[model samples]
Target: MMARTKGTANKASSQNENVVTLENPIKRGDTLIETITLIKPNAGTLRGVSLQDVATSDVNALIKVLPRMTYPSLTEHEVVNLELPDMIALAGQVIGFLSPTSVC
Candidate 1:
């Protein structure tokens, strides 16, 4: 059996997440958040959002889903303020998460 290190569990779980570096950082209270990790959202996060919409890069779908998926979670308002490039990047990541190839 392979030996498990202290962060083995965290490392395993991190495989299901992707870190996105923002070209335009978000200011939350006193902090500027330059990167956000997008977790491979469970079914609960997809509720009330359409898979087709997410695949199509629908703005409403992004607003509805991002806060549920992002680490340092974005509010709907923050999602709205994302730059066009950032939004495109986010949409692409979300689409990738839906792909069967994303599973180990």
Candidate 2:
């Protein structure tokens, strides 16, 4: 796992500010599919989650969304047992990414 931003450590910093800028811009057509394995927090045991499938071209939106997802709390049991809808619901609840986008 990556380290948390200094904004989270310092009291005076704003959490909403972008501290690290991306060197390359992720346009509307970029794609990334990562299969993240789950590990037990205390025991360091690897769970059976083989990588989840994610297909999205909205790179700009994903950058904002990915960081908010809960890391250590997600277990392999949750991923294997629950269906796609259930997983989506859980992710939305934990990450708060399901809010309606504003029309500009």
Candidate 3:
């Protein structure tokens, strides 16, 4: 077994696959959000949301689950206000989180 090197940890943290840079930034109060970072969800984060729907990139399911997984904590209004391209990108990230990675 090998110990994780500092360089390896730095590289892993440098590329955050879940951060969505908005094509059109959304405003919350006076704050203008440029990027949204979504954390990998746990079972609790999926509460009241269907995994199948999320895996399928269902908009309604994503809308329900995103706020739980997102940083800077979005409101329902904010989530609903996401531009089409931004929403699509976010949906893709969500799907990636649910997908299995290669066991290299």
Candidate 4:
């Protein structure tokens, strides 16, 4: 887990904050579809996974990171079973939702 930073938001900064809204909001009583896809890595390959590889990689780091955002709602088991393309799509949605200003 990453350490949380402490800071106070100024009135102006807080007031002018940009919020990203989801098109399909996750509401109460909604049942999300569960699906899984599997991929096998080739032997003796030096290539590492990339965004394009999201369609084929056996393990996606992005999928693991999503649980940190969804928490109890999205368990490790659910994340591990997620399809590569689906994981990539979710990651894009998360990034779009957060609209981070900078990265550490």
Among all candidates shown, the one with the greatest lDDT: 1
Off by over 4 Å in 4: 1-61, 98-104
lDDT (tens digit, per residue) of candidate 2 on 1-104: 33321223121125422122222212222331122211112211212221221223133332323333323222333344434443444343322222345799
* Candidate 3 clashing pairs, residues 3+ apart or interchain: none
Off by over 4 Å in 3: 1-14
How well is each residue in 21-79 modelled by candidate 3, as lDDT tens digits? 77787766556776778789999989988889999988889889888987767777788
**Whole-model lDDT per candidate:** 0.78, 0.28, 0.76, 0.39
Summed backbone clashes in each candidate are 0, 0, 0, 0
Give the lowest summed-lDDT range of ten residues in model 4. 37-46
TM-score of each candidate structure, all chains considered together: 0.80, 0.22, 0.82, 0.33
Looking at candidate 1, the ten consecutive residues that score lowest on lDDT are: 3-12
Q: Best-fitting candidate, measured by TM-score? A: 3
Deviation (Å) of 67 in candidate 1? 0.1
In candidate 3, position 38 carries an lDDT of 78
In angstroms, how far off is 103's CA in candidate 2?
Answer: 4.1
Q: On residues 1-104, what C-alpha lDDT tens digit does candidate 1 reach at each position?
A: 33311212221145533666677878877677777777888989999988899889899999999999987788999999999988887787888888887456
The lDDT ranking, best first, is 1, 3, 4, 2
User: What does candidate 4's lDDT look like per residue over 13-93, in tens digits?
Assistant: 343221212223232234433321111223212134343443343356445444444422455576666555555555554
* TM-score (C-alpha) between model 2 and the true structure: 0.22
Error (Å) of candidate 2 at residue 3 is: 31
User: After superposing candidate 1, which stretches have Cα over 4 Å from the reference?
Assistant: 1-17, 102-104
